[model samples]
Target: APDAPGATLTALPSLDLSRPAWRAGFDETPATVLADGAAAAGAIRRAEIATCIALGAECVGVAGHALELTVDHARTRHQFGRPIGAFQALAHTLADLTVTVEVARSAAAYVTRCGGDERSAHTLAVKASEAAVTVTTEAIQLHGGIGFTWEYPAHVLLRRAHAAAVLAGTPDQHRRALFALVDER
Candidate 1:
């Protein structure tokens, strides 16, 4: 029964990208419903993956778009007496963020191609979740303090990544799914 303590859920509750109400719902559903839930969950999972792929693309895009602007900003934005980007600290940070975003993008693309295998999907999901977190966090860091401010769009990207990580499953959730896939084998 859907009300059972460990039922596997099947139905993908209507979700609003503007909101995150399903995380709690999925957590509570009984595992018994997995028979039905798996199909629905798979569909939902696929959709979520598609969303993440698109988002990951955006992350890559922003990094590409911002590179020039960041270069100019670093060149012009004065610190104590010089441009902040000229400092090794800022340069390294930007470099690291760029690397993270690229790696995340590659991982997402690989995962998108890993179709149908539950185990693979589970692994891919976890990887994508990590990618989402890493890229978004780096994006925020590269942006500096303004990244944290609501007025900046960096927060919006972070929020979307966060939501994507939670959807279908969290990092731990996907890991468990991977284990399940192995066990099933």
Candidate 2:
């Protein structure tokens, strides 16, 4: 109902271009007993896994859009009497990124379809987030100094990807947990 006990919601400002975020600050706040504490940890884990899976999808969408923007720019923005997309180097890079995005997309979809398999959820999150960051960064670079500008969407995509990466747990944290899980098996 009300803000959870001592949890004060704060609107966080950022250079994320458009989407704003919030933080819940919990101090010596009052506690309202919701349910049994024993299962809380398990519930929290499931929630985190679900959140990561959703964020993975979001990452795919952002990366895919950024890739589209880069493709369009490469086709229209000419250099040295030809489109940059015509260059072998840039073409190869684009092709690689395209494959990466597609793979990430499929991974995200697979994890979602599996109902967020705990073993693979974090991995997919890491993959999708990294893919988004990679594509958006390249999108900006391909834009020639305009990528990070306030007028560019690449910066927004990058910001969103970073935010998503950190929301459920950073890639390093996810990888660490994954490694630990592997070790346990």
Candidate 3:
């Protein structure tokens, strides 16, 4: 990625937040700002699809984390002289989480691989949006009461998914894009 004019010459290989002075100042952004901004907007839409796929992957990871924690809690957290997770409710939850993770992973991967065309962009948006909601909800559910609590990490992931689901474009926006793309054909 070459610097676009006002993009500063840097010794580092990445954007540096440590030195705010070198960052794009208001004055430096006059010429390429609009063009770069437009490019960025378009890129965000595309990359958001990829990001949604990545977030879904994170959901799967969270599922595994939840399972491991569930196992640990089952062994340590006692209820009626037994682990609470030994209950059928807990077992079913673990199973459901596993299934949810698998489904999200498959859906995200499918959309990423298949949705490269203008037509598929809409589908990608749809899947990413859906994945954001589905994955966050399931992740929260699998974590039980703690999942809802502010102290828990699941909420962070859930929030991220929620935000990702809506960014770049909403589901309706993507649907409209699909229609527009098709209409152009």
TM per candidate: 0.58, 0.88, 0.53
Per-residue accuracy of model 3 over 1-185 as CA lDDT, tens digit each: 23554555435332222222233333354363444577888887667556544544544454445455555655677779887668898777667655655565565566667755444545655654565456556656755688787656666656655555564567787688778877888
- Candidate 1 lDDT at 30 equals 40
> What does candidate 1 score on TM?
0.58
Highest TM-score scorer = 2
Lowest lDDT sum, 10 consecutive residues, model 2, at 1-10
List lDDT for all candidates, in order: 0.60, 0.83, 0.57
Instruction: Please identify which of the two predictions, 1 or 3, would achieve the higher TM-score against the true structure.
Output: 1
Per-residue lDDT tens digits for candidate 2, residues 73-166, read 8999999999999999999989999998998988887886777788678788888888988888888888888886866687778888777767
- Which numbered prediction scores highest in lDDT against the true structure? 2
Give the least accurate 10-residue stretch of model 1, judged by summed lDDT.
15-24
lDDT per residue (tens digit) for residues 1-185 in model 1: 45666454454443224554433344555454443667887787677655545544544454444444455566888889998888998898678666655665565566657653455455555665566566556656666787787645666656666666665667787677667767887
Which stretches of model 2 miss by more than 4 angstroms? 1-7, 26-28
TM-score, cand. 2 vs. native: 0.88
